[model samples]
Target: MTQEKYYFENPKSSIRSLTEDEIEAAIADYENGVKISEICQKYPKLKVSSFYKQLPYKLNQEKCEYCNNQIYTKVRKNGYGNDLAKLCIYCNHDYTKNCNCEQCFHNTNVALEEKRKELQIVWKNFYTEYYNLNYTLNDISIFDEIYLVLLIQSYKGTFENTLDFSYFKQLRFQVHASSHEYYSVINNLIDRKILIPNIYYFDSYDYIYSSEPSLPTINSTKINWIPNIIKTSGTLLSVSELDKILKERTYSVEDKKILWREVYWSEIKSYIDYQINI
Candidate 1:
């Protein structure tokens, strides 16, 4: 016979562990509104998630008085893509059957209501930021107004380039003016070189607005369109030109020239102050 290795002899127990009846009594104490931490203090082996599982089962057992069969098990279903679960029961007939009890209905409704409240808070923040940025009016030039309106519309990714007549009508009414007045303001901006028109052939709008002023076709290969804008002397500027100037050093000769041509002296001082603070 081969020799066998032994570790240690098992000792016989004199003291007895808690029986199933004792466990049931502890569970009853938990069901009768005893604090979980208190129970944990008494029984150090109890876990939190496991303790929470008992409450729902105990509550369901009391609510489900119709069937003599113990609710052997309870399962939760996806609450229609919500942060909630649908209470279900396993009966003697089938494991797949859902509980259509009144208590289950009430729980589902309450959960859905709570979810709606959470969603409303999220939507409130979104709308507040959107309205602050786009709707609230501040001291703005006609050029800035038109640019902002177009930019917002573009961001929405809905309306076409063609002006929304309804929006124009609403704005006209709000300003206590006509479409002609709005056009006149825009025309002044063009004359003052505040709003530079796009030169692309495809962007031409003859029906609703005045024809874009004639501009030299950009020589993409030979000349840098941006730097050329800084060099040229003209009343009307282009968007591409402005973009280029903004990219260079703020106090550059080109920048000063552009500022001298476009912005007032006080405005220039304020701009300098703002840039310094930033």
Candidate 2:
């Protein structure tokens, strides 16, 4: 008979992982303000040394210029431990209490962007294949995730959200997604109960106030959560302005009409704001 050889564990060593009690005790001490160095001294055999080693920069901590205490900062690109500390954690928190400081704002933005990236990873495989789908859920990129949020904000009713295909088409270019791929993902979401089909409204610009009306109503909320923020070329387009541009331009001359539908998103606000500045 052949003896068993385990793949993940070392065959030569008799050591096994730490017990639940020991792991919990270590975590309790670390979270209560014990230094990593001290934790290593106590838990050398627990294999926490590797984790501490990866965070070498955090070890050097900077002293707050005002409070004269050690602080850790993630925004600073400098080596973790060697980062120049302008303020300790306490002082920094107090200063940004109002959230007006540029440093704090930048740091907050950094954090939001990190979260978006993290979500992108989470959404990477959220789609399923139980329904005979060709694409997997992980195909979702950062853009799709952002658009889902925008769609939620744009929805006006209790049951579902709606946007004209044309309006979505304009956005497709910015995110580098084609219409086929976009609809495929959307249909998948709908199948999953993540979306619902609302009553159909015309998306054409010419319908105006007539029985067949199609007007574009873009959302005007500036999405501060967008991390770097994406701005359209012009200011926000109001109903009146959209009507004027639609008539003035050749949009009416085409054989097929591109109607406007209501939409809620950052571009709606950002566009109007940009035009106002001009």
Expressed as tens digits, the lDDT of each residue in 1-278 for candidate 1 is: 22111111112211113345555555566546677678667766555454544322221332224344333322222132322222224322222235446555565678766654554454344324432321112233333444434423322112222222223333432222332233243323333333322222222222112122222222111111111122234332233333333344135577456545544654676677668769
Error at 121, model 2, angstroms? 0.8
The lDDT of each candidate is 0.35, 0.36
TM-score of 2: 0.20
TM-score of each: 0.23, 0.20
Off by more than 4 A, model 2: 1-98, 128-278
**Residue by residue across 53-148, what tens digits does model 2's lDDT show?**
222112124455455555443222223443232323344533434543456677777876765554433322231222123222233333344445
